[model samples]
Target: MKKHLSIFKLKPLSMLCFTFLILISSCKKEESDPNEQLQDGNSTVITDLAGDTQAAMGSATPGKEARPFYIFLFRLKDQKQIWIRNATDSAQWLKGKDWDLAFTGPYNSEVYVNDKKYRYNPGFEGNAESAVVMLEQQYDLVDQAPSDQVFDASTITKIGWASSASANGWFFYSLSTHIMQAIPNRTYAIRLPDGKYAKLQLINAYKGNPPSVTDLNWPAPYFTFKYYVQQNGSKNLKTK
Candidate 1:
């Protein structure tokens, strides 16, 4: 007697479903990789975090300019970015320690630490103890933060474009070309309000973090930067 043979096969509909599932999986993996590998091979680096992408094209008035530009507030601990619509209301932001860094002023280039006691700061009269100090070293090379005494003695609030010293801030403006460019090798070492330490690298201020932007009308205020926060309450910020 001959034995009967039977074979199971996938139907056309089942084959289609299997292909769709594979495509969905591939898309999810691409979206999940939002971070780049650090040189240290142990730490991950956040990449291309875009800030405010809107531009302040002044109102219909001929001579009157836009009163307030939107402020982009950031928290280093969770890597959260909030856009403040009501730019003038300091009470909302100062109500709590929700923000660590702020991007305000034209093109959202003027950055500040949420130091409440500092006059003219967004957190004025509040309880935040955050302070910022400019570091001359590159972002990846900064292994440690400056001493607390140095942060206590700092007086800088704005860390964006330097009108006087071209190399002082994160970016420089070309007077002849009327273009703004992010200066290379500029990083900020910040003292968080909770006394934690962080180092920030402002890579670009224009859209896509382009290497070279020549047009004055290029989409801007979309800041791209990376930062590392030391969660252990120590100054060891070795990203590389």
Candidate 2:
């Protein structure tokens, strides 16, 4: 009779242990769930952001300098777009850490982080610690940011068109077709100046963010990009 009682008590304890393990597994899964993280308001998606869409293609006349247009500087933290005339006074935007990304060059095709690595880059000579890293994986699949050492080793200054055979960038330019196409599954992992991490996906460059544009006259320089800034100051950038 005592042996039977002992066996019954041992079985209940074993079942309790198994139940505790299952609860632990469920808690871990919930903590790491991408959807739950997104629902907590840690992601942002900016679509159809116009980046100098009205600017002319090239110089209008021979021996005449083309009119310079303002560059769009974006602040990822607040989702604000600040316009700065590059030909004129750009010190307020370029010299400060108020901007995270700079949309420069013709049609705003080139992008630069606010790191003081180059003379013409944003936050030049400032105290910003921002960096950019390009990844070949799709945006949704990139759950973790690479180590800070990896960001330090990256050499991608501009995240624009791949002009040459050996160039690495976000878009592909077809010489025959004269079209700029954003490469699929290309995402940029950015280290914000404030020491937080974010993942950016440059979706399209056309006005409507179309999947494919056959017409050459389709209005362009309009950017459609989405990003998720890990707000908890950790590298958990899992945004589904």
Question: What lDDT does the true structure give each of the candidates?
Answer: 0.72, 0.77
lDDT of 1 by residue, 1-240 (tens): 121121125667866787798788778656653233223453334455554543444553433345566677877767777777773555577546898888877777778888878787767777787878888888888999999999888777768787755446787877787667777677789898888998887777776666788887666666667777888999998876
TM-score of each: 0.74, 0.76
- Model 2 scores a TM of 0.76
For every candidate in turn, the CA RMSD to the true structure comes to: 8.7, 11.9
In model 1, state the lDDT of residue 69: 68
Residue 155 in candidate 1, Cα distance off native in Å:
2.3
TM-score of 1: 0.74
Best by TM-score: 2
